[model samples]
Target: MPYVNIKVTDESVNAEQKRQLIEGATHLLVTVLNKDPATTHVVIDLVPTDNWGVSGKSVTRLRQQQVKEAIQAQAERRAQEQ
Candidate 1:
């Protein structure tokens, strides 16, 4: 039996997307390793942004920084247009 674990941030992932991910993972194992779908196990884990970090910063912080930068850029653009 082949076991696959997928981890993603606790973002807006709908049920259909989860279903597709499971299906795609199963298909990949079947095609690449010739694993039996019936015996293949796929698990998805969602981690909170605060628990997930990159480059010494949490995902929540990174996302906040991104939004701040976007807003600043937009303001600059408006100032230039005026």
Candidate 2:
């Protein structure tokens, strides 16, 4: 039996997408390694954005900061063009 663990942000995933992820992971094992689909287990761990971090900041905070910087850059570019 083969087991796979997939981790994603909880707020970014839905039921259908989760189902697809499980299916795809299982299929990959079945196709590549010739593992039995029935015996393969795919587990998804949805961690809260606050629990996932990079550069000492949470994923949610990083995303917000990126959007803010993008908007600010766009505004600055427009001002320069005008």
Candidate 3:
């Protein structure tokens, strides 16, 4: 069995979101990784926003904005490294 863990801010996910996440993530693994969805275990969590900080400030204040900036920065950094 394969297990996947997802971490995200609490405001972005709820019980219904968790269900969708598990199903969708499982689908991705099945299609891309050639893993059996039936045997894959997916765990979704709502991490405290404080755990993710951005731009000299706490993510607790600007969750969505910080997440967007973080993603963009990550992509930029990867592009630079490549």
Candidate 4:
């Protein structure tokens, strides 16, 4: 039996997408490793943004920083065009 675990942020993933993921994972293992589809297991874990970290900052904070930077860049561009 083959097992696959997929982790993603809790960003409202619907049922159809989850189904596709499971099917795709199963197909990949079957195609690449010659594993049996019936015996393959695929699990998806949804983690909160605050729980996932990168470069010593949580994803939530990183996303906030990205938005702030985008707004600043837009303001700078508009100022230059005027």
- Number of the top-ranking candidate, with TM-score as the measure: 1
Better model by lDDT: candidate 1 vs candidate 4: 1
Off by over 4 Å in 4: none
Tens-place lDDT per residue, model 2, 1-82, is 9999998888868889999999999999999999999999999999998899989999999989999999999999999999
Tens-place lDDT per residue, model 1, 1-82, is 9999999999998899999999999999999999999999999999999999999999999999999999999999999999
lDDT of each: 0.97, 0.94, 0.83, 0.97
Question: Which lDDT tens digits does candidate 4 get at residues 10-56?
Answer: 87899999999999999999999999999999999999999999899
Q: What C-alpha RMSD separates each model from the true structure?
A: 0.6, 1.2, 9.9, 1.0
- Which wins on TM-score, candidate 2 or candidate 4? 4
Candidate 3 stretches greater than 4 Å from native: 63-82
Ranking by TM-score: 1, 4, 2, 3
**What lDDT, from 0 to 1, does candidate 3 have?**
0.83
Candidate 3: tens digits of C-alpha lDDT, residues 1-82: 6799998776757678788989999998988889987899998777787877667766786866768899999999999999
Give every collision pair in model 4: none
Worst 10 residues of 2 by lDDT: 7-16
